[model samples]
Target: MKKVILGLSALCMVAFTSCKEDASSKINSENVAAAAERDATSGDFPTITFEETEHDFGTIVNGTPVETKFKYKNTGNSPLVVSNIKSTCGCTVPSDWNREPLAPGESAEFTVKFNGKGKGAVTKSITLTTNTEKGSEVVKIKSFVEADPNAPAKTPAKPVIKQVQ
Candidate 1:
């Protein structure tokens, strides 16, 4: 009876040790994958992809504000966390992100507003910093404005003034 009890205790210890090793192996594998991804995207983010990399507001009237949305999804096996988002100019304001963690198969939205006050062609860029093994990303938003609200209308020339009497 004593021998049987000792053997069962040994078997239980072996099972626990095997489970611990298995768990450790899984964690190590994840770490390796993350490191590889980081190396691949050393300069720029390759794991994090945006649905629309650019937004073009062809021609907007002066004083008008145009808002655009940038959407992205997490295609990797880990959670996606956006660390920071910055706009090049003050006129371009990015809405506050919820700062929620995105799971493996999730999506998020970032809203950006462009003030079309400046004249001529304007091109602005938004920098996104994330924790998807890659470091940061840049998304561009472009707009063209005529500025002059009273530009000559395309109406046909009015009849010439009556000749002086």
Candidate 2:
């Protein structure tokens, strides 16, 4: 029995040794140089400087759509790449923006449309995913939606009463 156990252990050791790989074999000179270059320029990150981070549409009628332009500039040493723009809700839509990489000191603008569907003091945010130092940035839109005079009046819900058993 001890001989059988020793033979099994030896077999397992051989299998593991054969499966082992040399970590240095996967790395090459080109890969090392690329990694070094990336590390050396890691501090050079693009920055987004918005002319106005927030915009207020003032008083607007409910159900009316409104739009505004948000201007920005690249104020860093690296190029700025805005990969995506997302809104907090479907009622707000963003469009008409530059899709190319913005060089340092270049300016760009995007349009944001808000479908005035909320009540008073409505606020929404649009997030931009970029290659900036912070990776992402946020802009806000606000408005006071007044009730439309022509809108149909909402009927009050009827109360339900439950009888005691």
Candidate 3:
């Protein structure tokens, strides 16, 4: 589906981009898998790597639904387990995840669908519970929703005039 392709594209981008400092900072599938083997021989070491932690939905029409994907990979040696994903509130909801134990170098994505029913600047966060060192990670989504132009407007009623015969 579209979501699958988008996730794959994100994975590819992360694999291709250059890291700024540590090798972990720039995780590629090739190195991640290699490290996984080393970890298996040594001990269990699970790490989570997100291609991008934040997503901006920009401007959206009021009462409309907007969405985006937060892509991640297990760069650790052990299988990465995502226990749960909690959203800040109902306005933003996580639609899907791979669910199974994510093997090292294997990629997955969490898709969030946001309802822009309230007209104003909106920000939401998703808390991911994983078996990583920190045990949790936060991903953010933001947007500015414009008023719905097609919404019906209220009009004042005309005053009744009294006639005297």
Candidate 4:
């Protein structure tokens, strides 16, 4: 008789634990659904679309400053706000983008200036922080800096012709 009672107690405990777990899972699901509903009723998200993510400066003169602009637009359902812009190195600088929120279908451009300090094949990246769904965007600029071909050639001073033959 005692064994039967113990078995019954064990069964009851198992059932109670399972019910508790189910209730907790249901609550979690309900919370998730509620959050989704709230998001649906709230403002929509913004997306950034660029005409081109990369720009080529072509061949540039070393030691000169060159700038290129990257065009973009807000293609999502909401307005887009630019939060930050950063360059990969100190020699490269990025100009301020549209400070105001860009409404959908509006277009703008961000300018990047790279001091033509490096030579040979050069590549730089500019990172943009925005209210985009992915949170960030990256733009690339590449150039081949050629040594100034117009630099004057050095001429050796004419050897002094000794007259004291």
lDDT of each: 0.82, 0.96, 0.88, 0.88
Q: Give per-residue CA lDDT, model 2, range 14-49, as digits (tens).
A: 988996679888889998999999999999999899
TM-score of 4: 0.66
**How do the candidates rank by TM-score, highest first?**
2, 4, 3, 1
Error of 3 at 64 (Å): 0.8
Of the pair 1 and 3, which is ahead by TM-score?
A: 3
- lDDT by residue for model 3 (83-112), tens: 899898998899688779999999999899
Pairs of colliding residues, candidate 4: none
Q: Which residue pairs of candidate 1 clash?
A: none
**Residue runs of model 1 more than 4 Å from their true location after superposition:** 1-46, 151-165
Better of 2 and 3 by lDDT: 2
Question: Candidate 1 residues 35-115, lDDT tens each?
Answer: 998887665422566899999999999878899899888777666788799999899998866477778778888999998
Compare the candidates by lDDT and give the number of the best one: 2
Q: What does the lDDT read for residue 86 in candidate 4?
A: 97
**Candidate 3 CA-lDDT value:** 0.88
- How many clashing pairs in candidate 1? 0
After superposition of all CA atoms, the RMSD between model 3 and the true structure is 21.6
TM-score of each: 0.61, 0.84, 0.65, 0.66
Candidate 4 regions exceeding 4 Å error are 1-37, 41-44, 150-165
Best by TM-score: 2
